[model samples]
Target chain A: MVVRGLAAPPTPWSKSLAEPTIDETAYVHSFANLIGDVRVGPNVLISPGTSIRADEGSPFYIGKDTHIQEGVVIHGLDRGRVIGDDNREYSVWIGKQVSITHMVLVHGPAYIGDRTFIGFRSTVFNARVGEGCIVMMHALIQDVEIPPGKYVPSGAVITTQQQADRLPDVKEVDRQFANHVVGANEAMRPESR
Target chain B: MFFPPLQPVSTVQSCVSGDVSIDPSASIASGVLLQADPECRIVISAGVCIGMGSILHAHGGDIVLEAGAILGAGVLAIGQVTIGANACVGSITTLFNADVQPSEAIASGSVLGDRSRQIVLDGRPGV
Candidate 1:
């Protein structure tokens, strides 16, 4: 279901009442909710039980071919904003071909670059993850910027810049695994619609 | 002066199921989910505010939210949990079998209670 945001605000932020703009090629499942000031790019698959709400935040952008798995939650704080790859301010910016696995929370102000794979149940809050990164399950990434192609192991907590910097680069096997997952999900886009 | 009484207008746009009781003064944002299994209950007291995209699932036990409790966006409260009155749980926090004290403040991105089963064993060094 897709709907409009709040018409008025009781707080300093959340003043916008804009509706979502979804491309025709995107497949949003019936049980998924996409509300207010959100832009869904082409060929994106929003699975069931997912919530992409931009009511408090002004705008969100999901690039083409990204897949948001079941029970994933995407929301943003009204106070902060991130600069997208396009150089504009956004509440959350998810780049092309990203995979947000089941039950993960991608809270803004957050930026996830292209081809990044966030594993199941991970939380990305107030952080910037560069292109081709792989974040494993149950990991918490907060208030940090991860360089491109980095690998975050499972159950790890990366809160500071030093920790993110010291992380190892993505292995070839991990990259292949992420690509495989993306490919598999992309094949299901037609069936999901 | 003739004044009309204040009418309680609480809006809930979430998907709710099973034995759930929501007070008329409670505010539930869009995309919030409340699921209670058989023989379990989820109670949202008066003045409670559940933020957008938060999920509350009661499994094998009751989940209770005391009056004026606030759950920020993307919070996941699973299993048995009790949030005391005026407790504020920040965004993206996960609670499992937690009993928050009254007026307690939980920080954002915090994971409280047991998550042993969810831990994944990665063979990578320096993790």
Candidate 2:
């Protein structure tokens, strides 16, 4: 990729992030943005107008067969979590088969589990989301723990553990919707021919 | 060439500075400003539609918009913002914090500056 030099340089922000990585099997749209130490997994669908920046945290990862849907933005955290005794640094980690909906933003040192569906215009900040969870539209998840298979209702804000624990279980149909997104995006890929 | 040319990749009188990464399938409309500061970057993902007159800037953090997302006209999302996949943000909306869930729809004329809070809108809201 060519980093075009401006006639008159605007600022020094251009080289903040290292080169991004996109797997061969992943479907990254022409207009999508992936900057700095970001790793997009196989069969993943990164839709139009989306952006993923890992400059601060470094090494943001998306698991296999996940869907990072439109207009989504992901930012890395200033401090990374240490995994076990290995001292491994982790910032933002999105699991496999996750569905991140439109206009959503994921900020800070967050961990989203596998097969989760984050709804439209929602915000997730510094939270830990469990697997197979359904975060409904306009929901806010901040510094909370969403147990596996929980379903957050629309406009629900989960600020504490009590609110997250009170949520219902994820429906089977909603999980299927997340699964179908993968195939649908492959069909929409440029090389689908 | 299968890979699109990078030279003149950005148009529409948009003032672009620093390091910005945009996917080929994404459409950056007119009157957009994409700027990156010393410690931040801008990455626009696939199938993204950045509406006209939108300003995406980064100061000390990065800006990333995931797949199938739409930033409506005159929108301003700055500093450590991550718009998730399939998200549809209405025109003139401003997002200051970070992280929107997948497929989330935000109405126009909205202001979401707090990362710990969520903005809820059903049908529409605007000036």
Candidate 3:
């Protein structure tokens, strides 16, 4: 369900009752919830039980062809934001073709670059994930910046810059797998709506 | 071109379900979800403030928020939780089967409770 944000004070960060702006090509499942200053780009698929709430953190951006899988929770703190690729400030900036898998949490100020795949049950908080990175399931990425094309193994806790820097590069199999998942989800966009 | 005053196009109220008792003086923000199972109960005392997008789920036990407690935005409390009087739980904190002492303060993004119980894997085969 897509709804308008809070109308009264203790208002949101934007201080206005901003409704979500979803591109016509995007498919938001009925069970999914979106509220307040959220921008959904073209061909994005939001599955059931997922919530993208921009009430507290205003102005979130989901780039085109992104898939937010089931039970994923995307929210932001009220204080901070990150600069997007376009140089605009956003509470959460998700780049094109990103796949945030089932039950993942993407909390701002967070920036996920293009073609990155965040696996199931992982948490990305106050961090920047560069383009083409593959984060395996059950990983915790907080307060760090991961360089491009890095690979984070499952159950890894990457909190400091050193840990992020020491991460391995994305292998060919991982890239193919991530691409396959994105393609499969994108194909289901028609039926998802 | 003339634009009207900026107002909400639609209003989504907080959802409260099943065996929940909230005092009239308590404040609940929009998009807050309070769900109690049939055998469970949720009691919200006076002067309690539950922020937007906070989720309180009482699965097998009761959840009680004592008087003057404050739950910041996006907080998650699940299963047999009791927030004592005047306690403040910060934003994005997760409390699972935990209890907060009276007048205590929990920091933002804190994850409290049993770590072993945090992840519940599906029982289905090949999952």
Residue B51 in model 1: shift from native, Å? 20
Chain A TM-score for each of the predictions:
0.87, 0.82, 0.88
Model 2 residue runs over 4 Å out of place are A1-16, A82-88, A176-187, A191-193, B1-127
Global fold similarity of model 2 (TM-score) = 0.57
Instruction: Tell me the fnat of candidate 2.
Output: 0.00
Q: Of 1 and 2, which scores higher on TM-score?
A: 1
User: Whole-model lDDT, candidate 3?
Assistant: 0.88
DockQ of 2: 0.04
User: Highest TM-score, which number?
Assistant: 1
Candidate 2 local lDDT, B16-116, one digit each (tens): 66689889888877546676655578998988998765677665578889998889876767557899999999875667645677899997756665222
Summarize candidate 3's per-residue lDDT along B1-127 as a digit string, tens digits. 1223323323378888999998777888778889999899999998899877889999889999999999987888999999999999987788999999999999887778956634335864223
Candidates in descending lDDT order: 3, 1, 2
What does candidate 3's lDDT look like per residue over A1-193, in tens digits?
4222333234335446589999998989998988889999998889888988898886899999889998999999988999999999999999998999989999999999998999989999999999999999899999999999999989999999999999999999998876765565565566644
User: Among all windows of ten consecutive residues in candidate 3 chain A, which has the lowest summed lDDT?
Assistant: A2-11
Chain A TM-score from candidate 2: 0.82
